[model samples]
Target: MNTWCVAAPLCLSVQSYADGNLTLENKGEDGKGKCPFDPFQRYASVMFENKLYSATSMNFLGSEPVLMRSSPVSIRTEFKSSWLNEPNFVSMAHMSESVMSASGDDDKVYLFFSETAVECDCYNKLLVSRVARVCKGDVGGQRTLQKKWTSFLKARIDCPVLESQLPYIIQDTYRWCDPQQPWKDCLFFAVFTPQSDTSDLSAVCVYLVSDISKVFAEGKYKTPVPVETSFVKWVMYSGDVPFPRPGACIDNSARKAGITQTLDLPDRTLQFIKDKPLMDHAIQPIGEAPLLVRRGAKFTRIIVNQVQAADGEKYHVMFIGTEEGTMLKAVNYNGEMFIIEEVQLFQPPHPIKILKFSNVTRQLYAGSDYGAAQIPLATCGRSSSCMDCVLARDPYCGWDTVGGKCIVISNSQRELIQSVKEGDASLCPGADPVKPVNQSIWLGGNVKLSCPSASNLGKTTWEQDSSPLTLSTHLQLLQDGLLIFNASHSDTGVYRCLSVERSKAGEYTTTLAEYHVSIPEGGDDRNVISPEAQINGPSLAGLQVVVGLLLVSLLALLAWNFYKGHLPLPWNYRKKNREQSQETPDQEGLNSCTTYQDAQRPALAEDKPLVSGIDNGSRNNNHTRGAAAFSAAEENDDSTFTPPSLQYIDDESEM
Candidate 1:
């Protein structure tokens, strides 16, 4: 027996290994300790600079956003809080999707959230949407009280509104790296508005904010900024517009009467609206604000628009998740939009508060009402085929276009064949067959080849040339990994059983077992013997000749009988009668006498009794005689019966 082994490819990895099994790595559970206030609501955690940072409020009721930083390995270690009150509102309530970005000399941890006032009264009038900044150094400390977070700057304007009739609010905030300006920071935030008049008019608006620091330093806050900022609108659909309901809640009475108008708008914007210099102290009118998204439209609700790298030159991609559970992905290319992919991450109508991206591993993590989920950006990077991207294992790596290389991030086991065996014989290196078997067997005979029985070991195939043999009809796979081939010339070949294994050093080892098969010459000729040759063999020739002569004599006698018409009784009777008529006058006169008697009997029956008792008795006797005669005739007929001689001939011919 000869042995062969084939190794499995090393591209496979155990993304997640547990209890002697492996699975692809998916989103993990929240690691923070359970809070008594709200056990259902858990804060999101991220690993940055080897430290785990978690964002939470001081109390469940408080809106102050605070960060707790600690080593990921030590969960109980002290966590430091970072943030300070700013010129504007400094309240934070469960900060949505926080991410860190380093620009120039400053490393900024950008926190995206829709600013909310704890007081319901203030919340209704003032909705602050902001991107908070924290330096990298603040998160490195281990003390909670020592760490201080400061609000660097806030958006100059509020979220846009539509018609002032519908209830519109900022739903969630998503931060992504700008594709066009990869080196510079870009943010995409989604605003969700509810439709008051129609259910279909709800909408989501996406605003692209770039170089947030410039917006703060330029005093855009003092300007009368456009209520409808440079934002893209996704509207909710209503079957019809010009809403029919005109109730106070459905009507724009307060806004139309200028009840909530003010001059505390952005400086640049107030100059344009009022045509004169105005004091920054005056409050701006909410009705004058532009609508980000139309109310009651189809695609309404908070949703992630695009998650991408800050610098467009990098291959960084981001995915944004909305309150409605829809995910949108965007790629940055030299100041232009490259690609935008959308995925539904959650069931519809649920709220989502935050969306963040991890720069180190390029995984997009989302936070919503149901829970949090992380999707690898590389998995969604496929251009034409989605399978190749989604099936990728490594989170840190991506598909390289130039080198045609797929980067591997994690170290895991690769599948390998363990061993090959034949019955009790091991086909591996040590315990194989003592002799090289090159035996040949005729077609329709069983040929057995065995391999070791192991889970990792895959099935083996018998190849004639390079093609696999048809194993269904002519081949059987035994439970012991023995390949049994039924008799067939196609089984003639150098059959090989190959096994492959991956070593701890990441190299593949192969072993092979081979056997040479040929058709036995004598066996073929023995099975193909002709019928004539068998009959003419030395022991039977005399007997066959004797039987043949006897058959010929019988056939000649039958043919003579048929030619003489002796085999047909009717023809023979007619000939006999013709011979007698010409030769015997007494026989001819007897025939005439019988014919005359038959004609005289019919005339005598007409004179028989019509009412005599003796005649009736005679009639009954005649009826009995007639029944007997019919029975005898029926018994004499043989049409339904088969003769033994004909059955015997049929049986002999069939044999």
Candidate 2:
């Protein structure tokens, strides 16, 4: 309904990322032989009659394109027919009832292909598009058309641009049916590009199953007649056709006798196909123009599904595959077409050659040059956040506020839809914060930091300390949002992943994942960090180093103070002048100040004499004293020696 809306992702990221829902595994193998056109152009593959069949080239540009069949138990069957000369097939289908006669001997498999005419070689090489049918029970004709289709008949498919009347060549075709509707109403949608490559115009023509059958019933046959002096002239031949149609699958009516065979058929019924190959009437698209008219990329394959919404209304959802490995989903709503979304399905740019859909699983399988891959038709759960769920205009998914997740809608989706339409975000309390992930690595080593986003619809950039990094070999930002390459301590910083998202509202930027990287100084633990460390956050080796250094400095400070003995007490004295004044000086005298014992600080006390009550002789270098023997105040003997100022001693004694 709206231009491709920008929605939030399950987890906010530069490229919207989540648990990848699309599971891809290589299926079959790389195609060996190319189609009749080119090895690069893959052939048409289809599931017919409960068996897998593909019409592929013998080799790259080799002779007749062979129709190959493979089953679970049987070896591959390569049905070679000389009739299919340089035939480039467009599509295949299993004929519904009524497409065949009552003979009950013809095949239900039908093919639409374009080939050069053998009979009209004299006139010119006419590129004819025809519908061919094969037999189901006929292994090989015993006498006639052995190993070839006996009931093979084809008619022309008329497709032209209505406005310019430019003849468009069929490039791709798809057969679509709705189980809930009548099978007879099914139609074949063929994509066409003008024969002139210079023209940028493309078209889609819808051909009815019944209209194609009319060409076999009563249509003119192109017959060439030789003139006496001129080239052969082409004319429409009119004649009574044979009973069992050449291309019709046999039922159980007049053909029940089982006598009618390709050899038994006369020229009248065979000529029916020749005259009717060119149907002048044109088949048009559902709307005014083609279902889609894109400019650059061509639509390679398409498949349609009837999706029933909650209201019991069914809509035909079309999935169109392009040459750019993109799958575009569209819906025919209210007589208008709306493109729902476009997704990049293939890992490489390979044009989609075949498209198949499963109604049971709602999954689409695309075949290309590389291989076949399956993708879910709906990506509802990819809208995890409430804002994303509301913005993602998907019919099959919605936000489950109670469950705190985006879920595929089945029963409890009505409320989600109503809330989103009403812009009610009350259910979502708040968005979860993107916690900064921590990591530790050694210098000269390498580490990878991934910035996985929920959706891949944004531009990602790596910023260190909020500044863009000029990434080099030493620090690299990979295409997939991985920060890797050689690492060093300088690389450690607050690395953030910023994703830029644009919407009709405007451009919005957000942080995806913040990496707090730390590198250990020493090269001792040379290996990478542990897995547990990754989950619990980066190692605290850097923080531990800082704490260790602080503890060592504290211990050294305590030991240095004990050496000077200044730390025991900020103020200390071995001689107390007050106590010395009370007691007479015994035969021994007191010792001098021991403040300058530490070589770290100059001996300022040496400039002044000792201030003790008993000023005994010059201070002996051998003077020794313990704390238990001295008790005196410097104030008690100020006259004995000019004592250092008490104020100065107080400041100097302060350790």
Candidate 3:
């Protein structure tokens, strides 16, 4: 069995931009210190010119009530107001939201607040709130210090009734004006009817003033000019009139008793009595403080459920912040309203107090309990295909099936393509629109490109310009066709399959299919070490044999020299010196044999052992012995030999 081990190059992909957690501090307010009022209590509204205005209402122990206003971005206070009359201000309820309208001679901002009478008996009774108008002309100098405020021509409607009993009482108000027609200004508010003591029956109400001439008329303040009001109901829950219901009613029985002239039913005034029981669905509550956009006479509702504030320039786009920590977006095309998208703009559980849109950059800003946030309008929208539509830059012209000509998809689709041509002439050229794959594939692999089937048989051709090669095949008419390539370098380019059909009448038709093929650059196989570079196991064993042979040869040479007695020069000289020293004593003792013979003293007492007479045979034996001894001495002398005693001495020294 063969196994292959592969090692691929490592590559680390880098992010296009840095990614980390971002903590942005609150713009103006330091979180460490205590603010005079709850920062969340302030609400923001945007004007047509893109300036942001915030409103705050606080009730102090002082006699006068205080109203505060400032620019959205500035920390410095801009405008302040005290109560008109000095009465111990009981509970002061500032409108949670404000609206800006320009229906009158001057641009006016309508502020809504609820007030209660300071006296004991009236203390428990909640005063109905009214819209207070502040004209643009009245504001002058830096920060517009000189201020004038006027109550709405209508009496203050009971807030509880406006909140619950009356369907038309605005629960929330949004500021809006039409740029094209400034005079046709309008305010949108959410209306709700009180069903139970706790729940609100919701709807949307719009107040519109078509003409401003009456409001601009020259007059002094005798009685406040009553601006004509009209109400439009949207999203009603049941059968309910959009009007305020008051808790008290004065008795007009004296007129009926003939004590005074008969009076009309309070002429242009609506009153409600608490004694009267409410019938089922008696109140029609509209949207609370609804943000509105006026397109001609049609009023577009910009907010949905729980929207605290909304600001929009064109009816086509709107930015709405809800009390549920959510920022919702809706777009109006023609007369239809569609919620495009929504983003969780605030942290969970923090209610969004205000939402303002910038006219300069068209960005939307939201204020919540924590801080403020801004989101680009382009980041939001309805269509998931919008990104692709923008990249195509095709103007998103709707397809014309009948006329075969592409036309813009206006409000009406059919009307746009009426005069365009039809059939195959209108089909998009080139390959089918490319779509992202489920997963990226490795290089040098076959990929299938799908195209719609043709009614007739046609020729399919695949070409890669980088490879300078083309593969063509005749395909039977099929819904989906597949082209194959035995992996080749030339097949790496963008592969396209064109199906061409030639009719018998000489008409040629073609449809295109495209696929992208990539072949990574590098050697296909890995380089491996050659066997020649590795040591052989058998060669190591052979080296051991050669070493053994060399050792044996050296040992034999040493043994041969010892056996021959041809020891080194140092061993030879030591043996010779020992022999000479031993021989000196031996030579002195043995010299008497030669001297006795010369002196003829053989017959002396100690030496006279033998008789004179001897047989010839015995004498011959003696002479033989003497001759042998003499011959051994002469051989030794001629050979330069050491004496026997010297030889014994050398042997002992050697041992």
Candidate 4:
């Protein structure tokens, strides 16, 4: 092992901004120290025993990757082995810790990285990924590796290939840490993509902490022959190795106290680690296929979170980031990967290159070169209504009855999962149910029907007239329950958002929304309102009838009062029928054929009178002429009375 001095962060200037609880830290000035090493571009950092352990690299494309401890206090120590300087570190974790106890189990940091090497002469120079361990207390051997690592040992991380003996390339890794199983059971999942263009496939593999330890303990190794040719000179070892594994951490009860350092140890243990670093077996993914794969959208980083729901059960939640700035929240369900949601964390092309999750605070930190953002892991406040909370189906958040709000489930909630699934909504009493929306669009225009459902377990669907909707050339149904496309008259219907869930009681469907989508018959571009600015429905027909009658009564009363200028209504209100009889001269003016139509003074004459025989006798010569003159005059002007002059004419005719 060779020693290399590490640069400090004193020269590194930090630029930061604080908004509420979120703090964004951006790299300011160059931080290289007098040691002539560049500042780290990225790091695989972890918290162990209240301290941060990081496998960091500077000018990663150029050189110099080292392991360091920071935070709580900066720059506690730095270790730079000769083998480590060229490696590209990808992931790091605290393997074991023993600061609390004096019995001395071990405190170790495990780092995973890839390096280019011509190892053992068995294989030509090639790039390989490895898992390296170092004792936390190791200062170095006095002579061989001063200020360098003594317990430094690395092994190949063999990712098995389907058709080739060569290992697949390790692209990324995520740690699955369980607080319930501290030292015994921690595991890692690695993403491996094949080098073959024909296959062009990737897979996720799981490696147990116990399995990794066993490989270093009992596996055989390859060592170079002493007088070997340059090529193909390495063979399996046949000699006795050192006592107590060389990779194990140096501790009080570990070796004889007199030895004190790695220099006095036998050669077998050190060479064994060097020869055989690859694990004996390769761990496969949970399912038949990889966790996820796509021809486009390369994955950038993955972090695993364990969730303890109200039901006192746990879940594995994976937040995977992509190069396109999309973060997919997924879950492992019965060996299948279910993408619950996809959130665009930033503007396109601004990828979230780094992600850190705090289990204690339930917060997620996402960072890019420009800035870092912090958001809560559980968005309890986002569930504004009870229906929204239930639909979200988030295990960490539930409706709090006493607070009348959606809040993170407290420790006392043992049946949080069960409570949410009952669908009673009694947990959030008095909250208004979500209302269905009515939408109207113009013919040949665009229409988007949104049906919101929060539960990931439910299968969301759209139905028209109780029949399932099918995607047509122009009509599309999206996973988020949005039915959108060009609107037409044929699209007028009641669209229902139905969620079907399969349970022990068989399949049940719940209708989330009933959208009445209508195309306006009024048909004009000017009449078309943007979705955001659409007007409300017209007033009720009953209200219009009441208003019309009130306006009519008002006008009729005004006309009556206008006719009687001298007379006034009671309390100055218009009085009804206050006019006297009309004057004879004014009556004569209106007596002509037009106005005399209402004058029916001779109306009695038209009846079959008691004097029906008198008219027959009028045929006699005495009064026939006079009576006939008068009757003729009456017939011509039946609306007015005949004058006395007509009577005299009748007397003269009789004489």
Q: How accurate is candidate 1 locally (lDDT)?
A: 0.38
Comparing 2 with 4 on TM-score, the higher-scoring candidate is: 4
Give per-residue lDDT, candidate 3, residue 479: 45
lDDT of each residue in 454-519, candidate 1, tens digit only: 213223444544455565755676655445555666667766554432322232322334567777
Clashes of each: 69, 27, 28, 6
Where does the lowest 10-residue lDDT sum fall in candidate 3?
273-282
Query: What does candidate 2's lDDT look like per residue over 1-655, in tens digits?
Result: 6785432212111334358654444343334332233545446667766766566665543564666554432222233332465677787787655444343434356677776654453454556555655545434334444444445545556565654443456777777776655555777877766655576765556677656655654455555567786665555555554565544544465355554444444455444433333333333444435665556567777777665653456666778888788888776545445566688778868888778887688678998878888988777767657655544444565677678777666657445541322323343456777799888766566688888663444578889888997878677668666655666667888888877644334554557788988865554355755443556555587668889999999999999988888666534443454455665443113333333233312443453333333325433421332121122333355423333333222333222
In model 2, which range of ten residues has the least summed lDDT? Answer: 622-631
Query: Which predicted model would earn the best TM-score?
Result: 4
Candidate 4 similarity to native, TM-score:
0.57
- What is the full ranking by lDDT, best candidate first? 4, 2, 1, 3
- TM-scores for every candidate against the unseen true structure: 0.30, 0.49, 0.32, 0.57
Whichever of 3 and 4 has more TM-score, that candidate is 4
Candidate 4: tens digits of C-alpha lDDT, residues 407-481: 777643433422433433434445444476788777667767877754555688888867888779667877666
Candidate 2 residue 538 C-alpha distance from true site, Å: 24
